[model samples]
Target: MLLSLPNWIIHLSSALEWGIAAALLFHYGKITGRRDIRLFGLAMLPHWSGSFFVLGYHISGDTIPILLDMSELINLFGSTALLLATLNLLKSTKKTSATSYTAALAAIMIAGKPQSYLGADIFDAILQLSSVVYITFLVLLLKVWRRDRTIFSGLTVAGFWFVLIFISVTIFCMYLATVVRGYPTLSHDDLLHGLAESLLSISNLMIAIGAHRKIREYKREQLNAIQG
Candidate 1:
């Protein structure tokens, strides 16, 4: 269903998705005014804006090295933001430290800038692998704490799994591109990419919904405390 879409439509859908997600995150952050939430929302901003780069490449049909470079840079920043957000989440649990996150960041930082298809694929693979560990741990935490009874606990666990799937799919795509010709298509129309995008957007929305419920509960508690 996704691969057949026209170029304009694909990127348009991407814009709609990441745009809505960013807005939700940002609004929630403003309401809570928590530093972690604020940073998480801020991290979402670039992923939304970065869709334009995908659109630019599609509409223009020009694979400029600079354009790809810029998009990759934006992607790196988003990854960093993701790492930070995960670290923030871990603060409450204290199950892990920032050591792995730091190592991932360092790996990305020390790596050479991706200038070719293979280079880009390798760089992205590393990023995905780095995130997979933290995300997996989060999933396990949710499973273990399943009895906590938070409204969001289920959704958050499922969302993290979905995110893991998307990242794994992305890594697989990189592998296929390495071995397959006409990979990702010169036109960039791809079923795997489309599926990954859809899954990611859905996962974000699901997590956002769960987070909103948590906020509502927090507000209710605060109001009740004030009354009591």
Candidate 2:
């Protein structure tokens, strides 16, 4: 394996936490009778599958480029799914301006990618596009929270945004490990790699815990209403 045991644990735990968060959100939607929320939960599965592709890449000692490519492709779909689901959640409200803002932001972000579209490879372009979509999703997620705080806990929303932090740190560590330290890849420098990945674990943990809290709160409200 390309990763150490501790790194493996971090990856596995991040995936597990994401899966649990999705399941909890699904259940919360079911109990609360919110179809949009259920769809949002379902939307998370593509990214979870993408994570497994990443794990497979690592398991192969990072030799399989195809696995990494597939991960990026699937993640793009995942980001789109999340964005659409969030828009659905806002269907009852007027968010034309907000949606327009996100659209313009997405365009700007995509245009602002480091390289020109003609110069970048397909996968690189896909990754950039996915980042833009994910950022748009994050922005809309905050809008959803402001519109309906009852839909998701503040912590849950924060966890989703925390992924940006993980990405930034990973990029910096990759430069330090590969460029500065002459390592082949960030994963080759276990310490920095682990440090960057641990942030992902923390974010996933927050998502799961926040979703669980929301579920419990909803269940309690139902129980109290029934008892009363």
Candidate 3:
């Protein structure tokens, strides 16, 4: 039953995820060449890498331990990267307070490490906070669009997709938590987890596409300015 799924399906999904990540990295590099975004993108690479690792583990079964270890590392990296990316984006908008917010969230996540048995609570809190932040961020994007419709058109599209994905993940996470607490016997947490992961992958892909478009637009603007 191993590798029962079509090989093409697996490769196609992997290719799409990595391709999106690469596009985001290229755009981030071109924008400001900032080390933070580059590092963020690098941190994201492992998640996609671990996906393939897990797929291989599924097929072989012998490498389950290695795949689990890799997955843990990837999760940690992604957690940190999400905080860093949000901070960087906020900083780009000249929001100095966002750094402090990011630091607080990072501290909470660090404190909630599994060794302390408080990681779950911390992670849950982080998710809740992220949901609020995402909503606020979307509102800000809407306000920006209203004020200067053309200035951030590409970003607006990107933000829309990002918010959609964020909302979907948040809802699924909430449902999963509820199911775990309320129906421990018939728990469908694993399915929920898979759904969340898939949604996140999709979200990343969408953001990468948005970033690519924004990068192209920025380059066009630069060229026009130069020629004018």
Best by TM-score: 2
After superposition, candidate 3 runs with Cα above 4 Å error: 7-12, 31-36, 61-66, 106-201
Best by lDDT: 2
Ranking of models by lDDT:
2, 1, 3
Checking candidate 3 for backbone clashes, the offending pairs are none
Better of 1 and 3 by TM-score: 1
Candidate 1 at 30: error in angstroms?
3.1
lDDT agreement with native, every candidate: 0.58, 0.89, 0.53
Please say which candidate is ahead in TM-score: 1 or 2.
2
Tens digits of per-residue lDDT for model 3 on 1-228?
133234425334644765575557645555856665565456556556655655655556334546545655554555455445545555555535665765665566466563544345554444444444444445444544454333334543464456477556757676655764563321234444445445545655565666666567778988999999
TM-score of 3: 0.56
Tell me how far the alpha carbon of residue 11 in candidate 2 is from the true structure, in angstroms, after superposition.
0.6
List CA RMSD, all candidates. 6.0, 2.2, 6.9
**Per-prediction TM-score, please?**
0.61, 0.92, 0.56
Clash pairs detected, candidate 1: none
Candidate 1 has its poorest 10 consecutive residues by lDDT at 112-121
